[model samples]
Target: MSKTPKYFIVEAGALPEIFLKVAEAKRMLETGEVDTVHLATKRAGISRSAFYKYKDAVRPFNDMLQGRIVTFQILLKDEPGVLSSVLNIFARSGGNILTINQAIPANGCAAVTIGAETSGLEVSMEELLSRALSVEGVVRCEILAG
Candidate 1:
């Protein structure tokens, strides 16, 4: 019999609330304020069982992060050639966009997200994100490594 490999959760920074809770719990434990794991979980409003389950599993963003990333959802302006421009930026950044999805603009803007991998190229997530955000007509660009 063979066992499947384990995976870690490394995108907590994108989720501010959960990230903060874990951080606070760590702080409490380090300072010896909570005393017991059960008390710490109660104070943090998280179940003791859940605390144990996710304690070692949860990690801060950019900490021990590793994955072949794909699929990003970008919110853009409803303007001429805005999407093309966005693609151009991705190309320049070495992202081989595999798929894109857009919704009908309801409030004078649209959203586009491209799924690409690092391929043979190597780059930090921060660099990739900065480049995406610098593109014109892009209201926001989020890199999701799922």
Candidate 2:
């Protein structure tokens, strides 16, 4: 018998490095020390391109009620922001990312495996499918739910 998948929620522009700084900036801003991106980036030693690359792609983790999770194996084109775009869908769909594994391209495409919890998805699986399919460089999206 197969199990269901868990999901998480993330921003559309968030990336790994940017995600860390954004979290830090949120805390710093709370202390009223810095409220601008310039200050935050300066303090964090992150470039603006890196910040903008993943500004909206960050998200908090979430686990499914059924305690199930899905592993999405994606084939992405070799280009900038392609991986981020793919992650954005999962983030926007409330896919709590547990881990992301990628490999070097073999045929102008890279394989990425993302483990996420599908606990509190705002949209249906069909919608998620549509979104993933709509990405610019996504060659394939294989959902491995078990």
Judged by lDDT against the true structure, how good is candidate 1?
Answer: 0.70
lDDT of 1 by residue, 14-103 (tens): 665754676667658867998888778778877777677667756544334334556678898899988888787667766677788888
- Which parts of model 1 are misplaced by more than 4 Å? 1-67
Please give the lDDT score at residue 117 for candidate 2.
73
Model 2 C-alpha lDDT per residue in residues 1-146, reported as the tens digit of each score = 99774545544355455677766654455567888777876787777677667555543332122245778788999899999988888888877789999999988999988887776667755577679978999998876663
lDDT of each: 0.70, 0.71
TM-scores for every predicted model: 0.53, 0.53
How many pairs of residues in model 1 come into backbone collision? 3
Weakest 10 consecutive residues, lDDT, candidate 1? 59-68
Cα deviation at 1, candidate 2, in Å, is: 19
